[model samples]
Target: MNIEFTLNGSVQKVTITSVERALDVLARQCGIKSLSGTCFEGQCGNCLVLFDGKPVYSCLMPAFMLRDHRIETTEYFTKTREYSLLYSELTKEGRSLCSSCHSGIMLMGMVLVRSAPTPTRDEIFRTLSNVHCDSISPDDFADAVLKTIQHLTTARKIP
Candidate 1:
């Protein structure tokens, strides 16, 4: 099957097997290494990607099903102002520890923050439940989300 789609704003067309996983197609075929495949099954959210502006586990999606869809990965998120702010905050105070799980956690946080700029603590926890960041604790994750929300709110305010 031949699939054509926009990857991080770049047009890409590739021939792949209909059953090929989206994660494999992106990483192996397109050189998109950021979409890590920690678990081939959907249990792990490591292969998360934005499909048509919504977060989806690429490992669970078939390549042929994305024939005309738009996919955005961590690379694209890093370029955006919102994500950059969160990234900076996460890095400050030695809080932004990078590991195999950082990409997926950050990606999921971006999606959650974009969808709910003022999410409650529970909402934040729920959003991050699927992630497995060894360097960060639950409290730390909640704090990050709260900080991101506060930062966004403050940025939107006119002094």
Candidate 2:
């Protein structure tokens, strides 16, 4: 089967079996270094990628399911202004996300903030629960995400 999609702003066409996972195609065939299938069962969220502008676990996504979809990986995500601002907030939080979880966490945080005008703490916490990293406390992570939302949505930063 041939799967056609836009990957990181480029149109990509790959011949893969219907059973092939999107995660394998990304790292092996497409050379995406930021995402990988750590826990092939889709529990870890390490293989997170935006499919058609929505966050999804690539480990469980079939290659045949990608026709006309738009995939966003950290390769393109890191270059965005949102990433620049979020990275700054993440740095100030003093808790570093391991490489495997960074992209997933960033995507999750961005999605939550963008999905609503003002997401409650419980909503942010609920979405962030998928983030399994232990280096940062949940409160701090939520705070950082909320702060980023404030900064992006308003001209003023939260003090």
Candidate 2 CA-lDDT value: 0.79
> Which residue pairs does candidate 1 place in steric collision?
none
Q: Could you estimate the TM-score for every candidate?
A: 0.87, 0.87
Tens digits of per-residue lDDT, candidate 2, 60-92, equal: 888777778899876776766667777777768
Q: What is the lDDT of residue 87 in candidate 2?
A: 72
lDDT accuracy of residue 128 in candidate 1: 77
Per-residue lDDT of model 1, residues 71-94, tens digit only: 988888787777877777667787
The lDDT values for all models are 0.80, 0.79
Instruction: Give the 10-residue window scoring lowest on summed lDDT in candidate 2.
Output: 150-159
| Candidate 1, superposed: residue stretches over 4 Å from native | none
Clashing pairs for model 2 are none
